[model samples]
Structure formats: C-alpha cells, structure tokens
Target: MADPLSPFRSSLLPVGVRELAPHANPVTAILMGRGGSLRLHLHGARVEGDMLLIRPGVVHGVVLPTRGADIIYLNGLDFPSDAPLAEALEGKLAQLAGGALEGGRDAVDELRACLAASASATLPSVADVVRAIYDDPMRRMPQGELALRLGLERTKALRCFKAVTGQGFREFKLWSAVQYAAAQMKEGALVRTAAMDAGFADTAHLSRVFRRVFGLTPSAAIAGLSVN
Candidate 1:
C-alpha cells in the first residue's frame, strides 16, 4: 500500500495527517464524515453529526466507518477561525445534523464540488496564508523555508504570503509562536519553560504577547481557569 497516509498541501485531501505531529500551529481542521469514531486531544473543539473541528497539535486516531464515509477535512488556513464565511460553513454542518441524513449522498457530492472549486481558485484566502505560516514557524521546515526552498525572491514571497493571508509576514509568525506557547502553558507547562520551549526570549516575552492576543496575561488566564 502507498503509505495510506497521503500527505498533500492544504488543498489535497478529504482526510490526512500533518507532519511534525504536534508543532504549535494556529490551524484547525473541519472533518465531515459518517460512522467514524475519532479520538482527539487538543485545544478548541466543536462537533456536529459526522463533523469534527480539530485544534492544532492534537493527537488523534480515527476509525472510518466500516461502511465507509465521505470525509471532508478543511484546515484553518483555508478557512477562517471565526469569521462570517466560516460561520456559514458551521451553519451548513448544523443543517446536516438536522434532517440532512437523508441527503448524505447529496451532501457528500456538494462537499466534493466545493473542494474542487476551492482548488481552482485564483487567490487564496487570508486564512490560508495565516494558517500556512503558523503551521510552520521556525522557518526551518519546508513550508517555513518557503522563499528559500521555492527560490522566490524574499520580497515576492512576502507579498504572496501577505496578499493571501491578510497579515504581515512577521505578525503571523509571532502570533503562531504565541498560540503554540500558550497551549503549552495551558497544559501546565511552567511559565519560563513553556516560553523557552516555544522559542520565546523568555517567560516575560511570552507574557506580553499572551496579554496582547488574549487580553489577559498568561498567568491570569491560567489562574482564572484553574480547577482548584
């Protein structure tokens, strides 16, 4: 078998796994299928019928329906985190849950059509670029070394990234780092430890970014959610 694990760009599949496993990424996945059971461990979640929302860095095992299911996996980069369009997609999922079982065949066809249209589009969305950079931040991975690897001029590469993502390259880069680091902190990683582990200058640096993005210091946010 050809690795059954076929990996492709965000545009390539109805289902697949990401490399690096659990790199702190500001990405998400939307899975719509039937009769499949999935075990996911990560932040951010919501589900409906055969649909599932996946947070970045989550480890999971999915059991496809014995009868087989048509799954559509949408990554955050291609779909905004919380936006009107994404909300509309969520609405469709809700519709699927409410009496759309009878239309499973139609729904699957529709999803495949949408995927085809999305693949042929000329301009990528802002969400796509943001998710792309976030998916690989160290500038070490293939996606990270985009400009160098693709042999594109630095300026051109940045232009393409920004045009599609609606964010400055640097901004998305830092934000992606912050998101991953924050997730670790939430998992009870020590302040300084999480910060350093996340490639920050130190805990203080991480604290500042955390406050800026989430409107609360990392310590305060974690404290607010503490069980004890």
Candidate 2:
C-alpha cells in the first residue's frame, strides 16, 4: 500500500471557520475563505481579504469566515516572490472554493505545479538537512550532532539553516514532528499513539505544542479534517 502521509509535503486541508491566535508558521501557507473574506491580524495592523499568503516563520493570526477555509501548505525550499505566487494561488483556490476544481488534492497538485515552475535552485547542504528531518522526524538528532554530520561548526550549521529555510533548525524539526503527528491522526491513529510516533513526550506535550503552533487542540483540529 502507498504511504498515506506522502502527500503531506505539499498538501491541502479544509478547515472550519475559527479564529487563530498569533503563531509562527513552519512552512509556506495559502489560506482562502470559502464564502467570504477572512481577517488577518499582523503586527499592529489588520487586513481583510479573500485569500492570504503566509511565509515560513512569520508570526500572524487569522479570523476565518463562517463558511470556513481551505489551507494549502507548501513544504519546499524554493519559494517564488510573494505577489506573483499569491496571485496564482488565489485564482486556483477560488476555483476550488467555487467547486470548479475537482477536489482538494487536485487543487494541491496544481499549486505544486505553480511552485515548481518558479522554484529556484537549492543548495545541496540545505536540501540534505530538510530531507533528513522530513525523512524521520521522530529521530532525536541534536543540533551539534547534525552539524557534525554535515561537517560544519554548530553555529554555522544553525546559521545556514536559518538563512536557507527562514527558521531555526530546532523549530523546523519540531514543526516536522507536529506535521507527522497530524498525518498519523489523519490515518485514524489515537492522539497518544500519534504523539509517540511523532517523538512527542506524551499526549499533553503534543496538545500544548499543537495549540501553541496552530491555535487549536489536536482533537479540535483533527475532527472532520481532510488530509491530502
């Protein structure tokens, strides 16, 4: 059987309307309201729009509409310029919201195509780190150990990761684990089982991290969630 979590790298999920507190995103995300404009809360400012593009590590919040929202997550190292990327994704998401697109998976595939078209070349070392984390998020690899494996000083490795991915290595690892846990839950795993599978200490630990990063408890977010 195919791995159900394979599509998580660049996937789409449909979520019900809910307000999210300010939190840092671990990957690039595009959010579109289903029936109306969603409100975005930024630093000392707020904006209302039908769609919003959030880059990795950006701290932001959202007030979704009554009809809920469609969120697309892109977990790639190459990201195009924000304006053009947002414009293209907005059109695709609009089609999805209007039922013109076949489904969330199809929409995600189209979005990935768009991303690929504009993706720039990535450094090998950076790609290596990304691959390692995604390949086994449960592994407890310390920063120093990773740096040694990469044949660089610990501080340089940290800088390289932050510069390439726009987030610290530890932050990326935690986020990857969280995403893995979410995928497990989508496959009908219990929270406790998923937490352990994702390297979380326990259910409470997973809950706290989930709420901190996503502004929703695991149970709440996993209910009726569709993972591509």
* Candidate with best TM-score: 2
lDDT of 1 by residue, 1-228 (tens): 111121222321222221112222234444444444433333443232345444433343343333322223322234434432122234654454222233354453344334332433323343344445556544422334656643567778777765554345676567667666766765788888777766788788888776554435666555543422
Off by over 4 Å in 1: 1-145
Q: Give the alpha-carbon lDDT of every model.
A: 0.45, 0.68
TM-scores for candidates 1 onward, in order: 0.45, 0.75
lDDT of 2 at 133: 82
lDDT score, candidate 2, position 105: 59
The segments of candidate 2 whose C-alpha lies over 4 angstroms from its true place after superposition are 1-8, 76-119, 224-228
lDDT (10s digit) by residue, model 2, range 197-219: 99999999999988777767788
| lDDT for predicted candidate 1 compared with the true structure | 0.45
RMSD of each: 12.7, 5.2
lDDT of 2 at 128: 68
